[model samples]
Structure formats: structure tokens, C-alpha cells
Target: MNAAPSVRAVIARHCRELLADPLLHGDPTLRDIAAQCHQPLRVLLVGNVSTGKSTLLNALIAGPLAATAFEETTSSVTWYHGPEPADPVLPDPGHRSVTTDFPLAGRVMLGDSPGLNTLSDNPRETLRMLGGSDLTGAAAAFVCVLVGGRVDQWAEGLEELAAFSAGPFDLVGNIVAVMAKVDEVDEAVEDIERRVSGDTTATFRFAAVNQLMAAAARTGAVDDRIVATLDRLRTLPVMHGRSAPAWDRLAEEVGTALPPGHLKALEQVVGAPAWLPALVAATAGMTTTGAVAEQFERMSRIRSLEAVLSDLADDSDLFTSTAAVLRLRRLAARLKPRPAALVRARLADLTATMHTSGLHRRAAARLVRHTDVGSGLTEHERAAAQALLRWPDAGADGGGTSDRATAAEVDVGAVLARWTAYEADPFRDSRSREVAALVIETARHRLRTTTRQEES
Candidate 1:
């Protein structure tokens, strides 16, 4: 028996066959798509200016690929594929920059466009690039890095994805939302995920990552333990008065393992030792003298983004199928008497694979819109379902919905009463009753946790 063909092989075969078709060959766009399919999968990094789009790209592909940045040319779109480029050309070099050299270049072609909010019509270009499935290849997906703060504050930026995604007969997904520089924020990673989870129209997969630590991890200069140690030190209480001398000395002693450069950077970044987390935040800007690539790679949270990228790469066949369908549609679009039957037949073959594609699944993302109450389902229920799906024995491990909305924000007492009613409902079927019982238990646990917080 033969092993199933790899996604790359299938995509290559599909592109070759499509290119040979006399019908599509005449169209430059489809031909370009055919040519691009032969290249590695592309993941576009799109976000507003100074949201660290270029920095994140450098972290991901190890080239200041976004350096040929900003609105030097209205139609400029920098492609970072090939053997990996030389050190990044920074300060927007006033021209396009492209190179190959860093690792994973062949496996993935990364595109870093100018910021969405740049003076150059880059956002328009970005939308065009996103809409042009042929140019980016079917396997191309996007990472929409949102600025941290109120979702309402970044609503316009988040909504930009919808506009980019908007096109007749064009269904785009496989887009992930990543919160960048999350360490600078006051919220926990999980809370940010929760708040942003309300923005259903924007991103499907949401992750709050500390790219600084991720860069550290990738650089081999720092390990998870070191990051953890830095975090611990940042929180350590500093001594001041004469009575606090011993504690102050101990705090200094604990922080000694930190690199001198990192310490200095932290001092500069934080200004004064106001608190522990502040020190931790300062560690984010520390850079290695000779290890730009590794340094950026570790802490940039590029690894988290890469996991999604790799997933998209692994599903290259779906991308290929998606691209082929789009091409067919485009060809059909150009026809006076649209070849609906012909296009449908060609597209029909892809429906099964399309359903399984990450793009389609992403399109079907379960959005938890904010109402006047809790998100209906507690975090625990979500975890239990996940556990049951993945591995039953694993169960829930401190992963559940945090019912943080106060009674003032929404009627807390009424919410609990409903769950209680469901739990005690005699008319509920046995199966439903079992589920309700579980819900009741979860609510009770949540209330207890909330009570502890209030008491503390």
C-alpha cells in the first residue's frame, strides 16, 4: 500500500494539472497561482502600524523582512520567501526589501506587508493581497495581531479583517488573532482571551502570548525556567526603611542571576523598582548583543503563532483545493455565459476537503458574544468537553470559564437561579438533567471561588 501523498505533493500535482489546462493557461492570474503553488505555504502578518508587525515577522522568519516597510510605494507588498534574507533592513529602507537565509524559509514563505494604518495605501494593498487568492496561494493564511486594550478601542482595526475578507463568492478564514506584547498589559493572558473572545467577527483562534519569552526560548539564551525566575523576581517585594534592610538585600540576591544587560535594560525600561511585575515587564525589551535572531525568536511569542502557521502548512492540500476553486470561480467570473455547471463540477470535488480545511472550520468559529450575563457556558464545561474529545483521563485542569461579571454588570442572582432551576427541573430528560446537574455543580464551584476573592 502507498502512503497518502503529502499536502505539498498534492498541491504540486493539482497546480501542474491546472496549469496545463488550455482554459486557465490563457489567464495570467490563474497561471500566477499555478506558479505560486509550487512555492512554500505563505502566512501573512497583517496589523496596524507599530503594533510590532515587522518585529513579529522578524521573530517568526528571522529576517527584518518588514524592514522594507511603510508607504514608500503605494502598491508595495514585500515577500519574504526564498533562502531567508540577510539581517533585516530597518527604518522602512524607503524601498522594498526581500531576502532569504534564516531557518524554515523553504518550508514556509512569509509575507510582511506595511502596517494596516500606514500612510501608504497599504491597508488597501493588504486587502487586495488578501482578496487575491491566486497571488498568495491557497495555502496562505493570515495572522491579525491586535493591539492590547479595550476591544472597542481596536474595533476598527479588528473589523478591517471583515473588509479584507469581503468579496462576492469569496469565503476566507484560516485567520488567527494574536495579542502581541501582552506582558505590557495589566490583564492575565486568559482574561484577555475572554474579553477578546467577544469579538467573533475578527479572529477565530485567540492567544495571549508573551513574545519576549518566546524569543528567549527560541534563542537558546534563556529557558522557561529563567523566564519564570525573572517573573518571580519582578514580583519580589523590595525593602526600603531600615527595618526592611534584610528583605531588600534578599531581593537583590534573588535578582543576581539575571544577565547584567537584562538587568540594565529592565532598570532603564522600568525606571524604578515600583513593583515586581514592572521588573518582569522590563525584561521584555532586553536584547542580546550578538543574538538578534534567537533573542527575538524566543520572546516574540512567534512560537505560538507558528503553531497555527504549521497547522495551516500541514493542511496545504486544503489550501490548494481552496485556491483551485477560487481560480475556477475567477475564470467563471470572466465568462459572459458563466460556466456555472463547469465551475460547480470542478468545485464539487473540493467540498469534502473544504469542510475539513482549517479555513472552513475557522469560518465556523464559535463566537461568544457578550450579553447582559455570563457567557452561558462556564469555563469548566468547555474544558470538560475538550477533555472528553481529546483525552478523557486528562479532565479539567484549572481551565474553565471565569464568571467575573458582577451582579451589578448583570443580574448575578438571576443567572444562578436559572442554573439552579435547570438542575432541579423535574421535566428535564435524564440526559439533560445530568448535564444540568453538572452545570449546577460548576456554578456552585464558581460562586465559591468568587466568594473567596471577595473575602480576600
Candidate 2:
């Protein structure tokens, strides 16, 4: 579906901001990058080793772009799309491959990545990359493919996938559990499917055991054992939602709860909260329909902004560049008037849209609307708007001094001096610290510029 006008406006605004960003100016392909941002669907295939992940990748692409083998073959995260065949293997610090191709369902771009359970020592890192990839901002759905096996194995895989899928970086209402290889199970798959579906509260899509068996028959790679496992998987209901709580409950019931070492391992690899075990249980017990719906909305907005920014940054022209800046400035102004409330309202509106149009379009629309500079005040409105922006937290009763006092006072000169000291050793400490210093300096510079402009 095409994005609404407001959505388009928000995206345009973000494009403007990204173009204005000093860091993104070097690249010449910004315009192409921006266009890619507008596509509707970007589905990703992610799962454990030998779980028909490659086969699924093949099925999605309908081609042999992803290498499939008996043994774990993926050495790094490989991205697959469509049409173009350019292999620019740039070094990505985050261990991700950026590709532009894949079928377009409206504006969506489908993505295929390396299997999560590969033999590499960096399997954890691979999963991290999958979870952290910019695809999170670009994706409309995540199809998690898995084979049916012993309950224990299935449980373990689900737990691992869940841990990787949590937090701010998660897909928005975009997760689907695909049970492949269902033809081998002796019993009816419906019973198992129903039971598991009840346990997870997330939507489960089932593929009959025969579907994979037929594909295997054609390929001759289908082992009887693997087929049987696939049958079991078919009979198994697709488990959805957070697996941590279910795993934790099972552990507590068996009195074999995760040990401290295992817990620490999960924390380090997954970066979940220390109380994640409890949180998972709580999330599982609570109805997640509302939460999932909300997440979809938030994701849509984020993606929309990403697309807009990509476009604005890539296509540099005088009007486009100026438009981008004005858009963000207007956004900042809107945010300043009742910053918290505006943010909340925008978030809510975006979330509401997710249930109908998937995530990306809604997100695109949100980005356009939120970022549109023209939506803010005209010149006549600037004085009042600027006053509100300057002291957003001011109380109705006494003025905004109390609120301003509560805000953290930034010392830009001190921050800049510290940054200069660290210039010789940039790798020391966290990059976030460095970025914070830069932001402080920028804010100070902007403030001074504004003061001077006002005086003149």
C-alpha cells in the first residue's frame, strides 16, 4: 500500500535531517539509498543451523543465491535481495552484509541472512548482527524457520531465539514461526499445533509435512531422519512470543533452573536485563496482543523515519538539503511545545496504524508527518513557539525556571576540552561518551549562534 500523505511528509522531514547530518555527506549513492527506504516489505529469514533456513532462503528468492549444504556452510552473514548482482564486500564493524534486492511487495524488500546456528565460533555474534542489523529499522516481518525435533531441542532453540529477539531492537509485530518438514510425523499435526499455539500466544503458520518432503524428493538432500524430524515439527504447534518465561517456568518446575553461569552467559550474549527470567515469565503470563500491537506502531514510525533520512542524505541538492533542515527544525519545534505529550501522541497514532497496514508504511507515514517542517508555526508563530521551545518544562503557575533547573546543565567547553584530550586515543572508553561530548558541543555552538542571530 502507498504511504499516506502525512506519512510522506514525515519521511521527507527525516530525509532533510539526515542530509543535514555532517557524518552522512560523503556518500554519493544517498539518493538510491533513500528510494530503497520507501519499499513496503522487508522480510528476513533467521533460524538455527540445519533448520531448512537455507532452503527457506532459496524458496523466498526462488534462486540459488544462498549457499545450501549438508554441513554448516555460512561463514558470515550473507544478505540476499534481487535484480542487481554487485558484490561490494565492505567491512561492516557490526558483521552485517548490506544488500539491495529481493521481491518488492509494494515498497517492501525481502532479506535473507546467514543461519544462526552455524558452526562458526561467532554464532552468537552472527545472531547479534541479525538482531542489530539496520534491517530492524527496515523490516516488515521476520519469518523464523525451525524444524520439529525432541521437545528439549525445540525448547532450547526457542529459548535462544527469544533471547535474541528481545528489547528495543526487536521486530514490530513482524515475527512469524514457520514449522517446516511436517510430512514425517505419524500423528495429525493439528493437535500438537493447537497445544503449542496455546502455550505461546503468538500466531503460528504451519506447513504440512508433505510440502518439504516433496521439495526434498526433488533435491534428494532430504534424509529420512531429517524428514521424520520435519514431520514432528509439522505436528508441533508453532511457539510464539517470549520463550524465556516458558523456559524459566519449565526450569522452575523441574527444579533445574538456569545456574548463575548460564544466566551470566545469557546476559552477556543477549544483553537482557538481570531480571529477564522474571520479566519473561511476566510477559508470557500477560496478554501481549495490546503490547504487540503497540510495538508494531512504534516500529512503523521508526522505519518511516529511516527511509526519509536515507533519501534526504543521499540526494543532495540546494532545495532538498534546505528542505531537510527546515523539516527537522520544525520537528524539533513541535517536539519542544509539549515535547513529551507530542512524542506520546505520535507514538500512539503510529502504533494504531500497525494492525492494518503492516509496519513499514505506517512507520513511513509517521516519519513524514512528525518531521514535516511546514507543519510547525509560520514566521508569525516563531516568537511564541521559540519561547515555548526554549522553556518546554515551565509550569503554568510560576514560569519554566523550575523545570529548566531540573534539566541537566551541560558544560560544552569542558566536554570539548575532554574530547580534545581523548583525540590522541579515540579507542579509549566508549564511543557513546565521545558522541555525548560532541552533542554537548554542538548544542552549545547552536545556542551561541541563535543568541547572536537574535541580537543582530
Candidate 3:
């Protein structure tokens, strides 16, 4: 009766079958990579063009990560993830490097991508990038930030958000609207809050008081007004007044709005039972997974385009073929990832088919593309990709247990046991030290590896 457990059982069965194969067992790295590919959580930032998506990103990281301005910014999707910064922040896989120390929180990974409006020569490419990013995993939640502007400007964005929320990915509810740049608004913050609260269609639970106060505080401009605003935000009765709304609520709202097959992939990322309804709702209007596959294929094309652009930018000599240059710029302007709405809709369709037919291998196969195998991957990319393709069949039946499921079920008692052991003999077993060393080493290796690839 519990859809999550039922679906998970099916996934586990398939994984077991795959792991039993000798070819898969021979490569442990591939096995591990495949395991990680089974599910991943994605958090997407949704807003209108010129909204402070990038600014919020910078604020979250507490450093200048993505480019931001008062005008339309964020030309492409930028992803940020774990291992916390020890000294200075660095971009994953490729792009520019940073040198500021920032603390990290593991609750969620953040993605800042191009917004809906465009002055870019390649708007299609931008959309493609957004879609590609969506396929990477389930959108755990959406941060919908709105700047002070006519409410109508947000209509399209709200529609898009609503569509994304409709998909399976939002098993628990995934939309959180934020009224950003509140300081610039002429009305009192309370009035704005009241107005937002009154709006039933797209009312926000959380609002960011203009960071003007936070910014000023950093510079020692501590005023009573700033303190008051912060206090009000901290005490606001957003999202049913309970300390914090469960993550599932956010996941559900977004999942219900997205395209079908897209949301299932997203649902996998978010994890749990709440996703079933969202998945079912998402598939209500779709007939097949063709649309979902098309979006992923489109993303691959965009990636290829980005590769071409990077090559051309690095060396104009690379473009000996006239067709290549034209193709390069043509795709560049259309680089945004696919919309959550589209992905949600597609996912819903796929899930509906799966539920009816008792699991469709074709649909399962199609969902595989959403897995992220890391960027600028070398030998590992090919290996990771292969493992990802075979992951659905790599569980207990195949001779390996499901670490994810097991990890997900660790008892609180066991956690307490481990904590007690650590406290009793801090360095007796030194397992914690080993884990720390491994993490540090892995982070160092990742940084070096990316740097070398860029240099190459």
C-alpha cells in the first residue's frame, strides 16, 4: 500500500539482479558510482528574469559564487554541493576558481540557473541547460524568490512553478516563495507581508528582509530597524506556524505541478512515501516517456554545444568548419535547462505507466539519463556512465546489498551507540579520524583533478 516501499522493493530487486552479474562485480568503483546514481536530491531556484536568484545563492554560500547584478544576470545553470569549504570556495568540475573560506551545510545542494526572461542570443540553449539539470535528480524543493515589481511580472514564473509543483517530484511539496528585495518596496514590510499572505494563488511562507540589514551589520551599521526586521522574519507565521514545515510538504507542492516522467526522476532524488501522489498527479495528462527522453536528449545536445563553445572560445582555430561555428552560437543562446514543469509532467506520465503495467523497463531505462556523473569526467565518466546504466539491476539479487536503503534505515539506537563509543574512547578505534582523513583526501583529490582537467 505504501508506494515508496513498494517502488523501492522493485528497485532493490532490479539492483540485486544487476549486481549478480560478473561483469558488474569486477569493477568496484563502477559499482559504487552505480549505487550513488540510484537516487539523488536536487534543489532548484525558480524566479523571473532579474530576480535575485544569484544574489540569494551568494548569500547562502556567504561568498561571491555566481555573478549577480540589479539587472538580468545568471546566464547559465551553476550547481553547488558538499564537503564544506576549508579555505576559499571552488567551483565543481570546471569554471573559475575562488579563494574565500566559507562554512558548508549538508542539508541540501543548491542550483542557480538562468531565469525565464532573456536578452541572450541563445535562449533555447539556456532552457535546455535548465532541463538537463532537472534530470540530474528530484527537485527536493524550489526557492521562488520575487523582487519588488508588479505582481503580473511573476505570472509566468508562478505558472511555471505551479506546473513544476504538479509533478511527482514534489511528493511532499517543493515550492517556497520568497519576497526578495523588500527594502526597495515603498510600503512597510508588514503591509507587503500582509498583502502576500492575502494572496491565495501564490502566497509565500518565507520572505527575506532586504539583506541591506545583514550587509550593513557586517559593516557595523546595527540599527533598531534592521534588528526589528530580522526578528520579525525569525518569528513570522509562515507555512502553518509549526517551527518549520516538513520537507515533504515543499516536495509535494512542486511535484504535483511538474511534467510526469520528470518528477519521478526528481522523486528518486528527494526520497520517500509522500512522492506517490505527486507522481500520480503529474502523469494524469501524459501518454508516454517520449517527451521526457526528448528533454534529456536536448540537454545532451546543449552540453555538446557548450563543449563546442568552450573549444571555440579557447581557440578560434578549432572551428575550421563553417557549420560548426554557426552551430556553436546557435545552441549557446538556448542553453537554459528544461523547466521543472516539463520534467514534472513527463515524470508523472512515466510513473502512471509504471503503476499500471507493474513497472515499465523502457520508462526505467529512460529515467537513467537524469543521473549526474560529475562534470568534465575522464576515464571515470565512461565507467560511471556504464555503471549508471546498469544500476537498476545492481542489488541483493546481484550479490550486493543496498547501501542507500540500509543507510536510510540506520536506527537512532545505533547512532547513539556510535556516539557513546566516540565519547568513551575518542581515539581508541580512530574510525572517525579515518573518515575525516578520507573526506579531506577526497576533497583535495577532487580539486586537483578538476584543476588538471582545466589545464589540459
Task: Give lDDT: candidate 1, residue 16.
Answer: 53
Candidates, ranked, lDDT: 1, 3, 2
TM-score of each candidate structure, all chains considered together:
0.54, 0.39, 0.38
C-alpha lDDT of residue 428 in model 2: 42
The local lDDT score (0 to 100) that residue 131 gets in candidate 2 is: 43
RMSD of each predicted structure: 13.9, 20.7, 24.6
Candidate 2 overall lDDT versus native: 0.36
Steric overlap count per candidate: 25, 33, 90
Superior by lDDT: candidate 1 or candidate 3: 1
Q: Pick the candidate with the highest TM-score.
A: 1
Task: Indicate the residue-level lDDT of 18 in model 1.
Answer: 52
Off by over 4 Å in 2: 1-3, 6-9, 23-36, 84-108, 122-125, 130-140, 149-172, 203-456
Q: Report how far off residue 351 is in candidate 2 (Å).
A: 10
Model 2: what TM-score? 0.39
- For candidate 3, write residues 1-456 as lDDT tens digits: 112222333332333444465533423322222232232223466666766677556555455567766577766555565543322121123312233332333333456767766766423433442333322222334566677723546646655654443332211123455666654455555576566645544422345444322222222233333222222223323422523334455435444444444433332222232322322333334343443223322321223322222222211111111111121223223333432233233334434643312222211212222222122233332232223222233221221222222211323233333333333554433433332232233334434555797999
